[model samples]
Target: MCRVPPLSPRTSPTISWKNCINESDPPNLQCGSIQVPVDYGKPHCEHFNLTFARIKTNGISCLGSLVYNPGGPGGAGSDVVFAHVLKGISVWSAELLAQYDLIGLDPRGTGLSNPMKCDPTIWNQRVSMTPQNEEEFNQLVENNKAFSESCRNLTGPIFDFMDTASAAKDMDMVRRALQEDKLNFLGQSYDSQLGSRYAGLFPQNIGRMVLDGITDVSLPGTAQLLIKSNTYESTLNEFFKWCNTTIQCALINQDAPGIFDKLIGTANTNPIPAPGCSPLSEHPCRSDATSEEILTEVQLGLIGFNGTVSFTGWPALSLGILEASKGNATLLSRPIITTPTSSDFSFLGVACFDCKATSISHIDLLLKRQMTSTLSPHTLGATQTYQAQAQCTGWAAPATNTNHALKPKKIAQLPELLLVNSLWDPSTSIVWANLLREQLLSARLVLRKGAGHTSYFAAGETSRAMDGFLLRGELPEQGTTFKS
Candidate 1:
């Protein structure tokens, strides 16, 4: 077991909880902030105030705090708690809700915390993430550099300190302030990396941790890009298959995949016009849907939620494709031009700080393009991977946390971890779960057989298993599978 120094009154930040629960909040919900060192490595340096919310247990018996992160690296933990958990409390398992107080901490540089900021004009520009030629690629590189500089200038040196390791340290400090000897964490998507790093740093402090929508930090940068590209291609194929059987599908009895490809080709040659789009002075709608916009919508649709609506079902995606094929771009362009908020900017800042390359190289670009083509040819290998590469090409901020791959040292007293994933998660991919399982010394893998991103939010068997583990310390049999 790892040793922790006794918490001194002078070292600890003040903890004061206020009744900031909104009308939408569930009973017993409370919110507060705690001041922490801006750079943990230099505790005497400047400090940042981190915000968090807690949903107190309803049962007579309390089982400490359960900290939650809804991925994005930039996703607001408090927002997730308020919107998904508290709002839909009925959907969650009563046992879990009654046992532990749900704690949501907006990590340093996200949400209620001192959020990272950048030039809105630079971020709002419609830049093609997937560049076709050398000139376009150069422009992308330049744009990324400019954006990175803007963030650095506005956010200051704190931009460099927003890495996952720093955030993980903040979590431990939160645990100390909560007066808990151990941490119970549920991290989704990119937050999985945060939780895993926390485990590596504080193994004995782990209580019952669940990492859903697994992200394998072990893979090399190039391999990571290929896996994501291939997974998205497979999920897109699954969408086509669903359309084949569902009569309500807009492209039913028609060649869905073929139509999608043809539409992309047409958009590549000439962007499809959206007549309904208002002038730029009035709204941010694009006059035409570029090929990049089409691909982006398809990618978002695969995640099962287009930003405007709750869930973008397969039928909705088919309808968008159908409209695009007929030379109308309204449906495809709507989600693309939706002006990004501060959270969106924070997402880029945190993500780039965590995983982006320090400097651009021609060899790296060529290798990425080749890998995307070879691994995910059907989808043209240009989605999130291409977007990340284009946007992070000339990222200037040096990574404060260099250890990307997490391998927790074996601690005999550490609690077994629970890992959950969908068999066909478009964003994270199932292979990541398999790889992560192997890396973690004590972990149980539960597979949710379905589409979409994370499984716990669905409140299905996978969710039940997760809740059981978090609430009662029950571990499902290794390699267990659940139908969503």
Candidate 2:
């Protein structure tokens, strides 16, 4: 039911770009902003400017523009351009750089677009996501409401329109401003969900689109969460297996799963001490890290893409766990900045808006929690996807862009799409990839037989297959699988 505003004379606003002079930014880096309606239904509604950064190709024949969204539902594409791509490190193949203007547009309310706000003091409170009782569930609801209210007070109307549909509309606005017939997109992680939204809305405007680490928007929110919980639980077992055999694994001499179970129990009872943390400090970590924090830490460590990738390895995770057992939980600490100025809080404003919401009575929430626990015994159903759904239980904003199967009439108009996925991706699973492929008209799936959230960063055969599609309009053979 999302209706994009009809194109009019004022649709394509001119973009004025200037050099990005941040110390780390490349010399050719250009940054600009485009204004789009806060609500497309009412085009005259107050507009917000989305920020973008790019490095224009010097080659004579440019392939128009390629927009890359490093999926956070909240990750700043502009930040990725400045920090990695423009630096000539963690870059696209040189030929892509030579042929296209690689642009990164920070979605509305994230990165440079006034970044969404919530009261850090209220957000930092330790409300258990896995509420075991009515009282605990009430606390969770109260915390979410307080945070939502704070956001509404500070962010104004644009906060209500932070959904993916609004964002896809913003992308089309960028396309018009860029004067391109089609937009070439590279969306990772949650961006797959965003890409799907864009395809449904402006299928004709899509050029070459790649949805990596795919999410099946077709699934119900609860179904997605349960499946992800199962994925995490299964991945945790893989980690346990690796730890038991690897000599470098700190838990090699001990039973890894048994130790993790005991640690979770100990944390629930006594909580772990984080001597290196200061809760009041900017970018603060909790001093008394609870079982919730430990479970969250475990997920972060289990981002096990491959042995060669420079992510926190299984050995490091074992070390983090062993250290937490004694006293210090510093190694497990992730600076959870919930301040108004920090983009840390934007995930809620964006993610909840993308979810399909239904009224959940307290009893229903308890049942959902019970189902989550029953499905994921080890992680306790603590994937970010599940936590996001549960947090949206009492969310104040309406879910404008909901999770549903893509319509064939609209999706049929989309050009060929390249769907890339890791077979063992911890967050978005291969199951979602296959389901998403079924929804699209002409799409190919590239499965990397490895571990990790994304396959592109692997920068090997999988990356090349993605590059082949974008650079020369080539599609990988339908069921290509690459070894990590």
Candidate 3:
């Protein structure tokens, strides 16, 4: 197992990147950075940098590098590609790892790439608008508007450059530079979109590609919001059923049902207090933030259905709200996991760019649907509505193709692919997975009875299915469903 290496001075004469023909660094992968154009359209113009990492066998028997992408328009695939591989499952056969060179490419504006960054205060600000009355509702809109504008203003042209189409082109360029005959692709979550788009554009080049956490490849942004909303709302109900069996969930008031209500109620009224570091601010400290910052803090909770924050830290998030309510500012930021990288920005940039929706109408309809349903009331829609609208309306850069979004094309001749979905995936829910499965010519769907976004790496039986496919090129029996 590769232990975390100590921080060392980055040395000169980085490894020369090309298809590996011999065992260059026995069992240890080498990584390096390559400068790519900021705009593929204007390649001779401005240039930004992206880092690529890989591991493979030596002396010419190497088939080619198999490139992998982890989910998250913002997740670091470069980290996963070089160091990790289905860790919990360890299904990547030793032989597979030894023979096929594994490569991870950080898309522009992501890890090690020239990242597009914005002030953390910009995303952390709270919105004072509660919308209990008409004045508050208008203030809510204005609050969202201003927040969006700040993000846009702070993250200008770099935002537009992060789109998926450009990243797909970048992948092709990497393949060429590596001197590979063809590229093998593996993408999860939003990476599925990245991979599939590449397949659509360059299908003949496809080699051993696997797409997990499938998003609705056929739908545009508007329809995608609807699918995920309805899917997760139902999964939430199922989650509560499981929560009812557990003491942790049962100890709270009316069990899962009541806890859900209480959580939303508190969040809606108070928002969460974020006493954390902001990446965007130079001062790196702020004690007083506005309602917009509070809104941003609460917004994070609504975006995912992963494990709950610990009781100790949970209140810190809550305190972030309490302080914001009192007109005190606390900085908000993501818990430091990996070093802040340019790839992170590129991931978010491409996600926003790939989305086709120009207005908030789709989200507005989703919120309405959630409210009308008995299962999702006391849900976290108010903040998300404002969040999506804020990004799309105020901050999101103009779409490259106002008239075009990827439409699902029938690739009916493809072999049956494995589809994995988390039961309560806040972003891509099981329902959406089922919907996408229907369109596939041959596919098997597995529902992870767990609460998380992507199932393959999140943990569960789904990992077994992923391993089976990757190792033997096998697919689960059609309609396979597994519990966590």
- By TM-score, who's the top model here? 2
Task: Show the lowest summed lDDT stretch of 10 residues, model 1.
Answer: 1-10
User: What residue runs in model 3 are displaced by over 4 Å at the alpha carbon?
Assistant: 1-27, 56-63, 81-96, 128-157, 217-222, 248-254, 271-348, 360-375, 380-386, 401-416, 438-446, 449-451, 458-460
Q: Would you list the clashing residue pairs of candidate 1?
A: none
Ranking by lDDT: 2, 1, 3
List the global CA lDDT of all models.
0.76, 0.79, 0.54
1 or 3, greater by TM-score:
1
For model 3, residues 35-118, the per-residue Cα lDDT tens digits are 455676666566555667676555356656777767567665656653453233242445557657777767766664555665
Residue-level lDDT tens digits of model 1 in 1-484? 3233333434656677776566565467788788777776666667777889887888888999899888876888888667645555343467887888889779888877878877877876766666656777678778888888888788766777888888988898898889888999999888888887887788888988999998875666677788888788888888888888888688998998899988988898799988767645454467788876788778778776222223566678888889989998877774323332366667767767666563255455666767776777657667665666567777766554556655445443457999998888788988888887777768889898888878887777889889888888889999998987
Better of 1 and 2 by lDDT: 2
Candidate 3's clash total is: 33
Candidate 1 Cα lDDT to native? 0.76
Which regions of candidate 2 deviate over 4 angstroms? 1-11, 22-25, 85-88, 280-283, 304-313, 357-362
> All candidates' TM-scores?
0.90, 0.92, 0.70
Worst 10 residues of 3 by lDDT: 4-13
Please count the clashing residue pairs in each candidate, in the order shown: 0, 2, 33
lDDT of 1 at 66: 91
